[model samples]
Target: MPVAGQTVGIDLGTTNCCVGVWRNNRVEIITDYHGRRAIPSYVAFNETERLMGDAAMSQNAANARNTIFGAKRLIGRKFTDPAVQSNMTHWPFDVVSGPCDNPIIKAHYKGEERHFQAEEICAMILMEMKEITEAYLEKEVKNAVISVPACFNDAQRQATKCAASIAGLNVLRLINEPTAAANANGIDHRGCEKNVLIFDWGGGCLDISLLTLDDEIYEVKASAGDTSLGGEDIDNRMVDYFCIGICEQILRDSKMPKDQVHEVVLVGGSTRIPKLQSMPSAFFDGMELCKRVNPNEAVTFGATVKAALLSGVKSEKLSEILLLDVAPFSLGVESIGGRMITFIRQNNHIPCKKTLTFSVCKDILPSVLIRIFEGEHSMTKDNNFLGEFRLDGVLPLASGQPQIDVTVYVDADGTVTVSAIERSTGKEKKVTVSHDKGLRLLSGRKRGHGYGTLEMYKLSD
Candidate 1:
């Protein structure tokens, strides 16, 4: 772990990235060379070739093929995933297939064709944040605590950690985005316990978390989210509505062909025209919605505030916080007739264990199928399968006589381990499942995966 003095809190966001430091007994946001506190997430590679930020936001209209945005939607997801497939259909930029059939963005940089993973795109943004912090602190910043969406799964979290490595950062902790938001909101209140629900609606995802704070311990009681729900949907809606208006105008004027107008309106910035500034009104027509926060800046602002709180310069007493975050979906096993028998419910507290015992219905039933799933759906086909294990070589026993005990344990880090024991024979089998892609670091084999390791990313004969 890096020393506290050398550590910083970074909010690597989907729309923008912000860095904060502890200085003069308070958290301070670092300003970039451009004098901007928040850096636009947009990135562009120009003809002569230079990467640009805020300056690139408007250039997308002219060089749509070289500009990239909303890469967050595809990060850590398989190319075959429904959400990624759906986004590829309408994304302005090109989505090409890459490793593991993952979606990679292709763009022209300085007359050279370049391919980048979503993680690499995010890493570039994080690197910019690191530059801003290092310039402000006048020292090399090595360690950081990064915030991720509360409902991010093991794969998504791992992907973020990998991006941190690519950005030349050592991630000390992966804090939940909502928990960080609640911390920024002062949920502690001098040790008074409180339950706060964080409803995070960002450009590419929606996360809802139920958290409880008690005497410095913050626990997540439940978490749920839709990977495809967010402000991007609203933007698409606006784009569609704007195109309709453009087509109607062109038809009224009889000035151009439908296909040409369609092409022009779709490729140009005309889609960003806020045709219905009142569109937000339709989002919460019946519910008593709080004033809608700025969809673009809220996550960055919240992250900035959190960075300050963790800088140790801000002295705020926090109530005990206990967070029991759940798997995004329910977990279960396969049963007779291809049915799913749920063993653990979603949103349950962590550090929990559950056990089930089954007797052999037939004298020669030598194997049992253990299927794991995640979701509320009762059918096995409707849920996401974590994996499957098969227990074999069961000793033949009288029907309904001896029982086999199966136990499943889930740890704080969302890892699931399973063990099975034959009650009469005293035979046992156990396995530990690791969702962390870089778990080899736990053995102290090397410092922080191969990113900075001379043996990993470096070329050798």
Candidate 2:
């Protein structure tokens, strides 16, 4: 509502998406054209028309195969990936392999089978947000900051960026979901720093971010969670409990060890369930969860705050705060023995850099290849290969004799750049790793860099 291309923060969740705008010295979540604060993350397509949000959700049952939902899990993933294969059984819609092995949405619309990439479907949802916000502000909306899960790899982040681009929104930044929540609800102190714990259990992912805050300065201390574990898992557990009698089921379920904490801030609509509320009480010793902010809209509210800050908006409150994040996984290259040697470990603050020296494997070679990866896997083949670049002018010596400095820098913009230079010649080459090659599947299981047995690293508290 401020002006054209002004910053708007968007929470593009797997189950629901919300948009917020910063105005009048505060961030306000905008209701959609349908008067809904939280829009269902659904999209339906027919030959004649397309519907989004509640409109699309209404037709999901009748046209289940034509409606796309839960796209966040599939976006940037391959048809042969284990996660994709696991989620396939739950979706009523059809998913097929795409041109590059990326998962594709298959729907029979207007008497024909139409295919759409996950990013394309997500773009439609983002476009809906753009239209609704434009109507509310009575002006064009362009710039936005979208949030993604901390565990999302380069490919997923890239896919999200692509969706925003397709929606005609210029992305200001892609903040992690928990970090955004901490910005919105966890950091409440002024003039002093405090440790805050955020329990972000959303529809598709449960993300826990440990943060330190002083007024507006927010820093992530540690982060851990299960990407596939969230409110939906709780619901499934609830259903299983009820099948055997709720009271009996809860009694049979093993009690989890209680963790010490300061204040537990809960975000996600699923927190509204009475049963979930009851379970956490046992874990937290019955401490009251913070409800000062709306669970459903807190992430978006934080997003708007970020957009306001990033836009250089003039406000005394905005000027006093700082936000910082950490690299979620270890990034490095493969060792000769198939070991993963980490250059950057998890929880290292962002905009950080690390340099590692490497040598050529053979003598008198013209080039040295560095294959970058992200994960906590012990073996290089078990991690996610992001991208690779070569120092072509290398004056190679005997194996393990030549030195090439490989520097990996993850900037504040959430993009990775890897640079390699031959120590002797000072020749260098750099590659910015983002969406395009982030999720490229190695077809042969054997390549220049061995096959990556991709697995989601489930970090526990």
Candidate 3:
């Protein structure tokens, strides 16, 4: 890779977004118009103009319905997805369906109905970061490597890439969130290998990645997360606990707090709650929470390490580092009986492929539907649906008489491509996985009998 114009990296988080560039031998976060390094990932509508980041978040209290947050959660998801349906009532804004079945965020702007997609709203945040960066550097920056959750599937990842494209930036890569944090710390510099856990608890999601740092190559062994769980959950849980405490105080003198545990590495703005410092003492067996780095700015710093690496910048501390990530969850299809037939399992390395054959359940059926899902569960209802596609134009056949082979391959960038063939007729159908039901991905090669679909990045010369 050859060096070009100025390049930067972005941490496009669910609750906030920030930009950083490798400049003058260091990574500096671009400050927004509000004089803050990281801007809120929010967007709002007004009578005369649309506002983004801090300006948009400020309107949340009084104009909540017109202030859209959490666009990352809805990106590339169908209006009918379980995640979308469950969250429909969460915000005061209107969530409706688009002509293509994608969920649209709508609000009354200037007394008129305005609709926006999750990508569009996310782009607003990205565009602001771009402006802030250009103004700070006094030059144009048009390239970036954006970070997403490790658990983000192909559709979600593409959606994020689309947001960057919309913001007029060419996305060099889409990296994982925790992986970026690990890079920020330069954990791979140690001569001896060590296993470390990254507890990425942010406002919108909680992800844990187990990684082995081996000099310049970092390998992720496993990853698990609750996409909808994070500091916000902690806030509500604490609020409920406060009410419980009040009732207990009225009934008795007081209840004693529990003990604290050992070391804790905190990140994100919510981790700064004054109660968090003492709660660890009360709940972690008397241990205290560690805030070695600024919680709100850590992710962006890590992202810059990656940005520097991807853009061919040389640093004695970070040059030539490579990252290999695992599939955060299993990738497979739903059987006719609603059983999940997985082709890729969790923790499998990326850039892998698998093929499976199926027998028809009905006679003379021209098609079969392959609905994809990701998770550890065995049943369809228990897993996360990625998308679905129909393998049509099959030769008319009797029950269990036709062979339909489906080959799923995940590319280096985590884009998934599925191909189906009718052995009898030689008719084949291939689709790049998208979320309106057929576009998404996973990557990696076989670990054992089954492989995975997510790999971090390879810094090849």
Candidate 4:
């Protein structure tokens, strides 16, 4: 029994997950039946049934190979990716390359061998969040605003959305984690101009976002991060963990002087470490780190507020705020001489569309292939291959006779949709390009299954 307007915000983190909702004029963290606010992001399979959250995590010692943690690290990544390959050595569980070259976890469930995509494992965690929310609200809730690291590319973002769909939740939006932290602090509502630095060091990633606020609009100036570096790394080398390198890197990349940053807002559990906290203070020349909001819960709080706003909840404090995000990397397609032609450059304002017109290289071409990629590299081979589609029935015109428009559109949530059109015949071929053909979630491998195709679901506009 889903309530029409029930919406919640989910912080689907690498090391943990939290859900919250706007209630009684403020954000309230939804607790599980045991009254725990934060839940470990772990899923385990055993003799009789699958376990989630604490249940899954507590038994991880005995079921290390069957317990799945850090699935977020594998989501939307190719099995051949250096990062994935590197992580594989440390994980106790087995990961095999899928047909699409994506990583798939293999574990024993009910005395049977089973394989699961990263998206599926994440979906189980998301389903637990949905159930927790439903239990708290006493009604079925479907819509949510989930947060991801600003560094997540198109494929990672779409895979996250796909996980939400599998969990039976409609994503109102996929927000950047640092941006959500800023909202939790009501930075835009402060009504004063300032340059704020948000340092988000979580379990699996560290996102540094520099934002400038004017009136009520918050524009992200620049964002930089190491997707594979986070709190877990710090824990491994607690004695020598210093984020000064990344702090200086972001400042250099954004070209912002340390003194100019009015406030250094800290997000994620890692910021609580005194050594980690001191590094930022020293780097910024002793400015106090803002800790007004709970480091672990700020993301959830902001997401809840955003969910409330999207749900059309009437609240004065939630209104009159605008947030603008940027494209983390340049998006383009393979062109002549194996080069890449960028349609959307890195740091470009999003919810934006850019089009490039071209003609077939061959005089009488039947079709043209659009091999899309994302990165700042000059060649497609050096960039991350996103996906591709073929536009056929081109009318077999001469090299320069046809006008084909290749349009790359990025929505506010950072999901990408690419389309190609032939103006002459008004023929068009469009795709979201985020989902790989071989990596699509298929409804199979059953012991009673209910997985759906990720591309088949889209949140209402």
lDDT of 4 by residue, 16-116 (tens): 99999999888999999999999999988777777889999999999999999999999878899998998889899999987768788988876777778
Give a tens-digit lDDT track for model 1, residues 1-461: 11454667776666666676655654466788878876767877766644546877768789888888877777777788888889888778888776556677888765667666777677777776776788878998887778777666656666777777877887766666655655554432425665544455555555555555565666665565566755666566643454244324323333323232110100001112354223322322422222233333334434444444444333443212334445544566666566777666676666678888877677877776666665677688886666667777778888787568878777654556777777767677776653333323222334432122322322320
Per-structure clash totals for the candidates: 20, 3, 26, 0
Q: Which residue ranges in model 3 land beyond 4 Å of their true spot?
A: 3-5, 78-90, 187-189, 235-264, 274-290, 357-369, 388-405, 421-428, 435-461
TM-scores of all predicted structures? 0.69, 0.87, 0.77, 0.92
lDDT of 3 by residue, 1-461 (tens): 74576788888888888788877777778886667877888888777666777888987998898999888889877798888887786888989876567787887766667666787677767877887898888998878878888778767887887667667788777777877776765532457665544556678776656566778887766665556665666766753464234323312311222221123345666656665445434543555555666666667777787778777887787766878877666888888778989898766778789999988998888788888887778998898776677877888878987489988777655777777898987888887765422122111111322111111101110
lDDT for model 1, on a 0 to 1 scale? 0.59
lDDT: worst 10-residue window of model 4: 452-461
In model 3, the Cα lDDT at residue 55 comes to: 81
Q: What order do you get sorting by TM-score, best first?
A: 4, 2, 3, 1
Off by over 4 Å in 4: 1-3, 187-189, 235-242, 395-402, 436-440, 446-461
User: Model 2, residue 456: displacement in angstroms?
Assistant: 36
Off by over 4 Å in 2: 1-4, 186-191, 235-260, 437-461
Clashing residue pairs in candidate 4, if any? none
